[model samples]
Target: MRQRHKPWADEFLQENTHLIIPDPSNYKNKWHEVFENNNPIHVEIGTGKGQFIAGMAKQFPSINFIGIELAKSVIVSAAEKVQESEHANIRLINENAENLLDMFMTDEISTIYLNFSDPWPKNRHEKRRLTFHSFLKRYENVLKPDGELILKTDNRGLFEYSLVSFSNYGMTLQEVSLDLHALNDPENIMTEYEEKFSAKGQQIYRCKAVFPNQK
Candidate 1:
């Protein structure tokens, strides 16, 4: 789907630099300094409209949340939500996930969330999928040894591909749910896309995978 351009996106980003960090690479391993606490950091890649990150921040006040989104227009909307919530533990990064290593150091992130990401189902575009091996390598590099990578998506193809990718990378699957909403998990924070899909009676797939100990 083509992105709808927002004319005020540039101004919004300029006015709210604190909420949507700029030159985030400078912070690298010092993310704790940004949140002013040593709390574990959790990141949501492709954080659309900030629903999941904002909800998670409100749900877990002790953990810092960083949302990485590449679309300026889309991220502006996310920043707006964070700004209104006034959640001190949440921050947004208007950057691409491919540059994760540039913005975080080894063991800097405790958990990573991939919520309703684009499937990129075509065989030719496999590498562009968030669960592709290249992206998993980046996640492994920044994530703590026991860091958990949680994924929630309505796309079964992507979910299945991710499971294989994780296992091939020697990651352990701690939990797998073919129908996440069927469990009625109270702790599950629904993203905007998840809400819409669930309303249509679509099943949600979720999995929590952790990397093997880095001996």
Candidate 2:
């Protein structure tokens, strides 16, 4: 589902500017300072409409959360949601995941979340998938020694590909769910896509990829 362009997107973002960092790269290695505490930091890539991260922030008030969305128009929506809820533990960033390393230092992040990312079904476009090996390697570099990535999507192909990618990258598969909703896990927080697809009777796939301790 494509998002409709909003002429007032920029203005909305500006009004909620406190939610977003104007230049995240400048805060590299200083994210803890940004949050003003030593609590672990978690980030969500492709944070469409801010459902999961916002929920996470409310659920775990001790941890700091950052929501990254590439599109300005789309991020405006996330910012608005956070602002409305007055969630002080959440921050928004309008940036591409490709530049993730530039904005965050090695071992700076405790966890990363990829929720309902584009499957990029074409084989030629596999590298662009969020769960692809290339992205997994990048994630491993930025994440702490014991950090993990949790991915959830409705696309079976992407989930299968991610399982293989994480294995090939030498990461540990901590947990997996072929049908997330069926498990009835009380701890599971539904993303915008997860709620929509699952309500329609679609099965959701989820997995946690963890970096092994360096021996």
Candidate 3:
């Protein structure tokens, strides 16, 4: 789906740089300084409209949440929600996930969330998928030794592909849910897409995988 352009997106970002961090690469290993605490940092790579990240921040006050979104128009809405929530533990980054290594150091992140990411189903676009090997490599580098990656999607093909990808990467699957909503996990924070898809009777898939510790 094409993103609807917001004419005031630039202005909104300029005014709310605090909520949606500008030049996040500058933060690097200093994210704790940005949050003003040494709390564990959890990142949601495709933070659509800010619902999940904001909700997670409210749910886990001791953990710092950072949302990375590439779309200017979409991220502006996310920033608005973060602002309205008045949650100081949350921050937004208007940047691409491919640049994760540039913005964080080794073992800098505690957990990574991939929610309803673009499936990029074509064989030629396999590398573009967030679960692709290159992206997983990046995640492994930035994530702490004990850190785990959590993924949620309604797309079965993508879910299956990710399971294979994680296995090939030598990551251990901590948990797998074929029908996440059926489990009615109270701790589960639903993204806007998850809520919409679940309302339409679509089954949600979720998995948590941790990287093998380096010897």
Q: Rate the local accuracy (lDDT) of all candidates.
A: 0.93, 0.88, 0.95
Output the TM-score of candidate 3: 0.99
lDDT of 3 by residue, 110-147 (tens): 99999999999999999999999999999999999999
| Consecutive 10-residue window with the lowest summed lDDT within model 3 | 206-215
How do the candidates rank by TM-score, highest first?
A: 3, 1, 2
Off by over 4 Å in 2: none
Clashing pairs in 2: none
Error of 2 at 131 (Å): 1.3
Q: Per-prediction TM-score, please?
A: 0.98, 0.96, 0.99
Output the TM-score of candidate 2. 0.96
After superposition, the stretches of candidate 3 with alpha carbons farther than 4 Å from their true spots are none
Runs in model 1 with CA error above 4 Å?
none
Give me the overall lDDT of model 3.
Answer: 0.95
Of the candidates numbered 2 and 3, which has the greater TM-score value? 3
What are the per-residue Cα lDDT tens digits for candidate 1 across 110-195?
Answer: 99999999999899999999999899999998999999999999999999999999999999999999999889889899999999
Residue-by-residue lDDT tens digits, candidate 2, 1-215: 77899999877767766688878998899888888889999999999898788888889999999999999878988887787777789998999999998999988999999999999999999889998877877788889999989999999988998998888878889999999888898878899888889899999998997976762
**Top-TM-score candidate index:** 3
* Evaluation by TM-score, superior candidate among 1 and 3: 3
